[model samples]
Target chain A: MAHALEPQAKTLAETGPGASFGVIQGLDPRMRIVVASVFSIVTVSLSTIPGLIAALAVSIGVLLMSRLPIRRTLKRMAMMDSFIIFMLVLLPFTTPGDAMFNLFGFPASWQGLWKATEIALTANAVILSLMVLVGTMEPVTLGHALHKLRCPEALVHLLMFTIRYIEVLREEYMRLRAAMKVRGFRPGTNWHTYRSFGYLVGMMLVRAIERSERILAAMKCRGFSGRLLLLQEFNLTLRDYVFAATLCIVCIGLLCLDFA
Target chain B: MHIVDGALSNPVVIGGAIAAAGGIAMGLKSLDLDRIPTAGVLSASFFVASLIHVPIGPSSVHLILNGLAGLLLGWAAFPALFVGLLLQAVFFGFGGLTVLGINTVNIALPAVLTWIIFGRLIAKGTPVQGAVWGGIGGAFSIAATTAFVAVSLALSGDEFLPAAKLVLFAHVPVMAVEAVLTGFAILLARQVKPELFYKGASA
Candidate 1:
């Protein structure tokens, strides 16, 4: 399905290319990576309502610690909610359980309501924590952290190159759109509009491929040997260890609360 | 389009993860060091595709364009698209962490399949001829992707069946728009850089 990364088109402008702040900024990038993954898995396995709420609370705590703008991060989480809202709204009607209410002769169920609430809580918790702990980190640091974490080298390289080029290509795209606007190209529900947009995409791809060729040549001239070197240095300090332990403890607490 | 975390049965989630891992392995195998820049740049290019919303009456829909990605990148579309999804989830909170595997499989599997089925035909013959095949391939990929997504939802539980069907039907218009756009895109590429389609490693 066609979905925008940000419904409001402000995620890029707001993050401004990743400004690390407060405690999350000071922690080792690798630590943040591990904590985010562990927390997500732990949150996913949680089922009880109270436990899920606490997970959301823990995520909020992380957001505060990261010093990311709270309203912006939660708004992004709400943006994701818009996509799943349809399925969630329909769940109560389709699911069989104790009756809650009726809409258009369709009886909604309490069990289905609980299920939707469960999903909503779990998704928000994971995404919120993820955005705070990992999303706010400079993308280049994330790549290097993955590299240090022993992810596949080529995959890491791809991630780095993609991060490096998104801004460049997006600028290229903006320029194209601006030129179209200057030419009185107003996109609408017409054959001509789709055709123009398609050509625009095609032009971007063609230019992208050609540009990469030039980059490869330039890199080769400087002894580029298929591998882009990552010169990031990482060392885990006591604070990173303490921060990771606290997160792990919180995760264990969540699992215990869910099961017990 | 994203399946946020905790929405699927454990088995479906695990199975999707395994499938995605296998696909990514194949994609990486096909992607040598020499092709990294090409693959990376093209992947970033497609990322911009989602930001371009085409107006459809009162509502505008962004472009997924995975079919065109399959045509250009072949098997390499797997990791390339995965990278895009990853960026979206981490940067924009667009999807979930645990569901990344399933989401990747849903989106990229169809892309690779389209490449397998239509990659060569879209490269050969006249520009117009290639574009016709490109259009077909574009529509086909969207169809296959929605089917996969619906199947994943249905498999997760009985409660999701209606939602599954709805997801499938809602994407019909997407298939048409994507088909036309992809056709025109291929037409442009065929006219400008005919050699772009020759890099189909899986072909």
Candidate 2:
């Protein structure tokens, strides 16, 4: 049943080099994107605990199918959980419902506990499936897919540009930090530290702007216009159709269980 | 500061999505194709910048330099920051897919607001004056963001009221840190590259 989730990848024959994909990577990118969104909406609408658990199960099932590193992906999900744990903890005390227990003289209601659980399960399920489905794809292909899905052309170009330059700028950032470290910079609770960090960011922005200027010049010299030609053409294979069918059936089943 | 998928009510989610879509369209309209490269690179730099952890007493908070982004990108900050948030959700799972719209609105709206309110003053001032305005803009962005986040939560249900309040309180130090860093960053940019803040109103 975990085979309910699938993905799309661009191999050497399909696209180009640096393809890191797995079993379900043969599915269509647009299909994966649509399926993930549908799954999230369904998961969020789920009210019953069992229904939500089923939604999470389906997400894990997708994770298994996508062949992503299981432990690492789940750990990331847990990290997100850590972010909201405080709010979840506050829920049991805040919601006015039947008293379940006492925490520091405050009544923790069962309804509140259930609400917290519902949120955790829903959040985890939606995010888990999202990571496995779309996150597994190459960022460039994701941009192309969004473009094909009728996203604004300029927005897609921005996404592609950001993806291409993130690594470059990250290297520049590391080099800057290295320089700062060599200067015996130790961040602490002080104004100097803040100012230095501020200067660091300011420096990065200045360099980035200069780099972009050079890039624009290079593009112009190469006879480049403003348009970015999205060269990737996605075709829905048999596997993609099967994946879509399975997702539809599974989502319907979850909704049934939720309303039943 | 990303609210997860199931945490928000449908009305809040839908409203945020619509609002973000409108903001993004406006932002994109202001950005012609030629400026795409500039905006894209700046957006990436901000993405990397957010990874920086500035120490605050016993602990540290990661930077959210939306104010700085606004001071540079103006209306374009919406789409630029949305790209960052989208990458975070997909690649890192920091935020959820459904909540992307709302998260973008919460973070980027304050950025544009900062640009509008403080853009001109920072540009016309001396380096030190520009830095001070930059600092206030930075704090204002975070404060507005926290307020937006709080309102998004409180609108969902009465149960989220306390959490929303706590969210605001927890961000106090973050605002202070962002302000100082943003001020210094603006100060440096003004001295070194004076055009940075000057372009804020129309970028």
Candidate 3:
């Protein structure tokens, strides 16, 4: 599990300092999150190619301005784009419309191609916007921003704890995995393997429960209450307002293009 | 089985958000203070569970384990699975932020349903019986989730119908694997720590 989480942990660590150096990183995390979410919603709502193209342009502009590692961002986008490409291939074959071409003796529809492109553009635009906006911010900052945004308190706390303990649990899992490997146990597609894996998961859960008990005890010893006290203060600067306004105007313009 | 952002129409997205909010509220209301740590730890466990990939026929599939979660956490599965989905979106980009609500609904609703339908059986049964019922709950939850995901996509447009079908067909193997895994998990839990199921039931 630690091995599996290495890439994610690395990405998170890489983004932490890079976020502070980004062009839009100066804005309040709340503002950045709100603007990015709004932009993504509008991007998803787009139906016309022109509208999507404009949304993509806005996203790219933010990406360039943020100075995120371009190669890493593109690699993530490509991973997401593979799903869209799958949709592209399937939609053309399954959708009903006037024939645009023949693929393996099946009539591919223009409407299918159109819808596929629409989905592709919408997904890409949203992914790019997130890479620039949410990806740059620290998870704790994002959690605080969500709390400020009126997200449910329980959900917010859950997110924080999940992030905090994920590494710990991954380490525990790696130990278990190592133990299994040392015993020459390799995962295979068989009932014996499934049962062994189940025991592994069960053991992990048992440990997790016991660990949580210890955590709760520690928290209570410290007079910990249900409410988390966030120390980070956020003040919206003039540049934040300007950036948000610009993003809103661009989003609205793209929406108007969708109707046009 | 996570749905990416921009995959659904506005109406579907709005509806999913509303429904998810209701589930999360119920989950939070039922969650007591002592249960909080358990929920958090279980949530983290669920998050890490996704990293466990098991070999299938020609391909490997990762664990979703919403069934086992529901069996152990009941209504809390909503928030637990939601946190997992949130982190997955944040770190791996497996899903999107905007569609988090819908994705939450698509996955967690089945979890809650399984809890409602099978939670009691697991609580009352012997080890072997618990495994049997747990297996049913596991496979049933996956099937229900695939159905929910398919309906969400199909509701978006006629053009998405094929994708919807594909999502369902793709999960068939996952359903079987989850059943076996959940069965063994339940068996082990019943033998090792029966208290977890009892606590889940009382919650």
lDDT per model vs. reference: 0.88, 0.88, 0.83
Q: In candidate 1, what are the lDDT values of residues A1-260, reduced to their tens digit?
A: 11234344443434543555788888888889889999999999898999999999999988888777788678878999999999999899889999999888999999999899999999999999888888877788888899889888889888888888887888899899999999999999999999999899999999999999998888778897765477768899999999999999999999999998
The pairs that clash in candidate 3 are: none
Model 3's CAPRI class is medium
| iRMSD of prediction 3 | 2.1
How large is the interface RMSD of candidate 1?
A: 2.8
Residue-wise C-alpha lDDT for candidate 2, range A207-245, written one tens digit per residue: 999898898888889887766686877999888888899
- Residue pairs in candidate 1 whose N, alpha carbon or C atoms collide under 3 angstroms: none
Best prediction by DockQ: 1
For each candidate, report what fraction of the true interface contacts it reproduces: 0.84, 0.81, 0.63
Predicted candidate 1 versus true structure: per-residue lDDT over B12-67, tens digit per residue: 99999999999999989988877889899999999988788989889988899999
Q: Sort every candidate by TM-score, greatest first.
A: 1, 2, 3
For model 3, the superposed segments whose C-alpha errors exceed 4 Å read A1-20
Estimate, for each residue in B1-203, the C-alpha lDDT of model 3 and write its tens digit: 76777668889888988988898998988877778888998899988887899988667998999988888888889988888877666655567877888989988989989999998898785899988999999999999999999999899888888888988898999999999989888888889888888877877
CAPRI grade of model 2: medium
